[model samples]
Target: MTTSSGSSSHVTDARGPLHTGPGDQHIYYGDIRASASSDRSGRDPRQVAVEELRALRRRFVDPVGSDRARELLEDKRAVMLTAGRGHGARTAAKVFLCQLPQGSRRFRELVDQAEEGDSAGRALDREQVERGAALLLDLSTVSSRRYETFMAELPWFLKVVRECDAWLAVVLPALWRAGFEHVFRGLVVRLERPDPAAVLQAHLRDVGIHVRRAEVAVPELEHELTTATMAQTADLSEDIRAARENAPPGSGFAAWLKTALAARAPGAQDVEAHLSGLDSGAQRALLLTTALLHGARTDTVHEAAARLARAAELPEVATPLLHHRTLTARLAEIKAAAHRGRVRFTVAGYDAGVRRWFWDNYPQLRGPLADWLRTAPGFTALERADRLELVTRFAHERLRTGPPDGLAALAERWSGPSASPEELTMAARALGEGVVHARYGSHFRQQLYRWAQDTALPGHRAHVVIGVCSEVLSRRFPDQAMIRLRHVSRHREQGVRVTAREALARITDSDDRLYRSLLKRLAPGEEPRGLRDLGIFLHVADPARMAGDATVGALLADHWTAALAHLPPRRWEQPLRAWLERAHTRPVARRPALRALATACARQRAAFGAVYAAACSWAAGDPARRRTVNALWEAAGSVPRPQPSRTAAAAR
Candidate 1:
């Protein structure tokens, strides 16, 4: 063997046996295979694999690397093929191939070595084919058993092979022969499906060479283990069923009621007799169901109570029915009073304390209240808004002190026209308290959005509707609030716009931080892009007030056109057209407000052009009116537009 330093080959004892020690300098597969057991004895398995790896590295890499050693060994192929002229050379090639990286390097070397023979006069024989098969088995055992070492060295091995393209065209026909197919198939399974050498997998299928997949016995073994243990489980289940069938008869209330009621006893006369035999818990369950069933009337309740008293020989039969006898009686009384269309109770008297008392014991009172509220003629006749306000106030007050019981149902019924500001306020209050019910959330958000856009509502009240939306609904319903804030930012009223801008500021807090950083870098006279998109420009508080500060006034004036045009014409008309129509007739004291409106309207001349045209039409044939229309147009022109930045240009 040639040494890495280009020294002559070492003299051997005609080789007695190869030693795996550092002083050893010969390769012997037979000696190494036998020494494996002794080398591994009383040693860590990982340490043994490491020691064996170092020996193989010394034999392979030290001999001018595996590629050169493989070429030198293949040079003796003609002699090795003839009788035993180069047996040692063939053995060296097999050992060297086993030490190389699995598929890419080893398989390519085998095919390349065979192809060289075709170019020359040599042809592959059974000896070379057997050597290749044995080398694959040995390598597979190392990879399948000592996986840690193979994986640790794989990255460097692949890096070496990938730097060359010569291996791409080679194919190993020896692997497709009988008895050698499994080695190729096993490598294909172990590699990724898109591996560079995946053509080998197609070749195997084309040649009809099938390697049976390994049987996966893990799930089957688990089933057998479970089946063995489940025999006792099956027997236990049957025994439980038999016990349920053969058990003694029950003397519980349901059993006794079944027997007593089966007789029918001419109109359930013995229901009280049956009740007397049950425990107190059973008695409460029975009477509560009976009183709430809608079939039981006032007389039926009294008769049932009287019969229980006679049968039990007590002064009275006590249950929640007897405890809240007044509320129960009031339930029956409400029907008659509700029919007459008047149930006298002052609204002031129904305070939080009264609401709390009813809800504190809601379980006992909900059924009767629900029955009266649903069935009472007066409840049905009450104005929709009034009824909604009543129940909503009750629900809000009750939820203020406890979890949402049945009050959400009452609040949900107040949809459509009944969803007033007061109703929305109550719903907002419930939401802020973390009372998350599906009914009060999205439906109420839709109602709040409609109310905010309702032009018929006075400006102050409409402002209040949105104030509740921003203050309470922003956290849970942020997207809805953002849409509303975008539309309302240009409201005709300065106070309402200021409120909306403040709400927009609260909702976009994180984005505003980023905008603030970019705002600092803006040139003194240049407008920032996406100013309206970031919603920062919406903070135009009382344009008259902002006009006093030159910096803020300049900022608004610069982006005024872009901001106003961001929303379309249809949106501005709802809140703005009415104000603009009277812009010409307003007193001189209101000129600043009118001028501010003109700044926004003048931005989108195409959309608001009609409004300006209508003003000019109304101004026709009157010099004074025409002069006012001309002044409005002049005011619109006077509002500033951003100049091209001289400072930015100079710096650039």
Candidate 2:
């Protein structure tokens, strides 16, 4: 059953301060302060991944075949983990990679091979497989066609992994094992589910809950352990932790256990029973509104409930206000409580249960609910936190149910030309939730790709798409993020293109590989777009950011060669002079910067002449600057220029 103790409780609300945990950092649009952390200065995604790995390590219990998998991985540098769904194969793969010795190597989950029929062959570029890198290729969700394509390329991929001395753990789909079993006989490790009791115990202890074996040996707990998957067991442990924290100060473990158990399996039944007694349309509207905005202020909930009633075409009662039951009494009848000013269900996680029951049992109401949510954020006095919470709740339900297009349609509507700034923010946040979802992330990526390539996309919608790319997708999927941003950078709207360019520059500058990737993508263009690319190149090519690394120096030289070949001296003179000025001032950057510039000019006489002219003008007055220029010119002259190409000679 769906419960609030699932990932939903990790969502921050207006009732409390936001906790900046590892899980919290990836949420792009929850709190304003949290949102600020998603900018250029945000925590590195690699570091965040490592922190999550560490957190996983704390709660992870080794499934059966883990040792064999590790042995195979160490011996072959690649191991295929095969297990049925809910057996923790993905987690086991990650844990295997995490157990490797820490070093300068990269650790990341590689995106799947592109879908069938695409000429790209495999999405895993050769440049991505660096030496000593630890990679995970989770193909559990691939379609049959994609899986066949992956199998065709698996041999070459493994060969590359071996050549690079890297480690790889592939989580294969269980259904396809027989088809490829003979081919990868020795490489496959069939993993079995770990003991549910042990999994639950580890999760509980990881969260600082101490319980004895005897304390957890109840009949109900035993039945759950026997029947539940590893994921559900972990969810039960989380529910217990949430229940304990929300329990009264002096409540014992028994009380928390009872509350958690009731919330875990029977929460939907509880909601169904509660809703059956409520006959009035207004009462039902208020109940559903409270579920969506559980921690909102009571006044906010009241106003939103009325709005929802109107949207659903629920008839207004003719009873006088004095004769009607008060809001507090109605709330009591619906099993919700108003504490101080905030509203929530009296039973923990019951709000989530209520939401699930309504969405699952009444399919027709989904349209009215979507329409109501479109204006609920605006008409109600929702704080930023409340608005974020509303969007997240709505997104979670939509993604969990069928037809994911409802959330997409609502987000697009909110991002229309006439939508307000608040509506736009809500739209972005709603899509952000989808981008970070475990199951529907690929769907949202495809959706954003379509939006990015649309010629008629509105400026406001472009802004929302760019915000999701920079803020949400960039954290875990930098490659996809860069691709989308580059597409948006070519948009007709100047402001949208500029914002996309800035985001691209910031994201690439933070990592060497990404920087090189962007340079390669932008270095081959011609004319007007070439000019824009040059501007982005200059913005990210600061020597201070490079830290004078030799590899960065080489990349800088290559980019300069492209720039020199395409643009006139006037187009690049200022940034070239700025580099020379920095060389004159900073001793550490002098050698690498000068060498890169000289190397860029080594092959063309005209390029050499442009650098020589720029340097002479830049150092006209200062003696030291003059000496640096002289040295740069000498280096350029030492490298002999190549003979002109046949095309160039014929043109001349």
Tell me, by lDDT, which candidate is best.
Answer: 2
- Candidate lDDT (C-alpha), each: 0.34, 0.72
Per-residue CA lDDT of model 1 for 1-652, tens digit only, reads 0011111111111211111111222122122212212122433222232244333333321212334434533432210111112112222333444443331112212211111223342222222221122122112212122233333333343233333311111111222222322222322211111111122122222334222222112343224223232222223223333433444575332232233222222222233343355554424332432332223334433343344333434345356854654534443332211223333222112223233443454455545544343322132233433333344454554455544544444433322244544343333333333222222333344444555554444443445445444544443333345555544543545455555555554443322211221222222222322433323343322232232233333333334444455544443332333333333344432365456556655655564575466556666668876776777778777765434222111100
Give one digit per residue, the lDDT tens place, for model 2 in 127-178. Answer: 5575677788888876677677777777878889889888889888877546
TM-score of each: 0.29, 0.82
lDDT of 1 at 430: 33
Which candidate number has the best TM-score? Answer: 2
Candidate 1 residue 194 Cα shift, in angstroms, is 81
Candidate 1 stretches greater than 4 Å from native: 1-358, 361-393, 413-560, 563-582, 587-615, 633-640, 643-652
Which residue runs does candidate 2 get wrong by more than 4 Å?
Answer: 1-42, 101-105, 112-132, 204-224, 236-266, 454-456, 544-551, 568-590, 603-652
Clash totals in order = 0, 0
